[model samples]
Target: MGIEQKAGNMGVVTLKLEEVINWSRTNAMWPMLFGLACCAIEMMSAQASNFDMSRFGMELMRPSPRQSDLMIVAGRVSRKMGPVLRWLYDQMPEPKWVIAMGDCASCGGVFNNYAIVQGVDEVVPVDVYVAGCPPRPEALIHGIVTLYEKVKEEKMKDWA
Candidate 1:
């Protein structure tokens, strides 16, 4: 792995910078555990023995935000929780991505009260919105896959 070289000009595969970065990022997405409500159960199910999310490189659901770049907001974010969410989002290092899992997090679901924030997007910028009261493990996986597609197309020029 010292240097990438063509095998006797058999065929050289070319990959865009974005593709390479996105591939690495998606393959090793370490999503932090930021579940706030019922969706937490479904989030847990995605990581349980049945789903085995390890194959997608999300087996370690870290509790500390400082150690993670991917955050799965898997529940309703109340008004009181908004500040906490922002604080944690700030704590995370750069190149961070957020997934608003479930309707509650994406749009406050059936909650139309003042206590609810209406959406986690008000608290943090969302990279993906997983629709449902609590999206099934497959749904979450699909959401992640969608994110991966986005990541793969991200332009490095934006960072510069």
Candidate 2:
């Protein structure tokens, strides 16, 4: 009843440029569509109509790293595959993020062998991790939301 009443319903609002930019980034993040193992299927399910990740502004799963801002490492990273994963991560634009999905990707799951990379964090920095052998689509969605919240609180100094 204070500012709104004085404005007479006029479309007027105030926000810091940092807030505006962060909001935009959170709403339009394009995830990379690079799948490595079984968890890849679960990742795809999040994009389907049932889970419907598009509503969160992640409808497009970019196959090209150049077009992506988020990298969802949905499966385990083998020792042999570590280099490839890092290469792909390096290809994504700045202000990028990563989600380690599934137990295998997070900590090697049952594969405690040298061939397994132990955790994808060894290959690329993970921003959020969704736990489970192959996490349900809902879990993946939650991780994305968590990332969004983190992005929203980012400072201008951090972007540089």
Candidate 3:
């Protein structure tokens, strides 16, 4: 007998399977159009026909945060931009995700001098931290896929 049969329920197993499928489908994200520095150019390159981020279902770069589910903090986070970043993050709907796309965004890079926010995480919750002085397009794509996997594994109802 299968695990479902041993548990005395075929219907419950079917429902669970459906839930998993739906979660995976919905979590295929669309990232917002926001990039601050050198990393922004790399991000653009990733979306271009060359690298093609569309394969992962994340090519739709929404102009508005409300329409996007993922925010890729691609460069340095200055103190002045910190509030703006937080506001943008807040604007995004529930089940949203954030990616710190480079050393600058992840930990302020070489700019430990004044005026920088130190790390994008200080302003918004980061789901994935992609390390590199400026990570390559491949690394960015890998981070997006990693985020998708995390979203798929999330227990929706339990998440508050």
Worst 10 residues of 1 by lDDT: 1-10
Clash list (residue pairs), candidate 3:
none
User: How many clashes show up per model?
Assistant: 0, 0, 0
TM-score of every candidate: 0.89, 0.91, 0.85
Give the per-residue Cα lDDT of candidate 3 at 111. 93
Top-down lDDT ranking: 2, 1, 3
lDDT of each: 0.88, 0.92, 0.87
lDDT at position 23, candidate 2:
95
Q: Best-fitting candidate, measured by lDDT?
A: 2
Lowest lDDT sum, 10 consecutive residues, model 3, at: 10-19
| lDDT per residue (tens digit) for residues 12-119 in model 1 | 669887778878888988889777889899989999999888988888888999889799998888888899999999999889999999998999899989999998
lDDT of 3: 0.87
Clashes of 1: 0
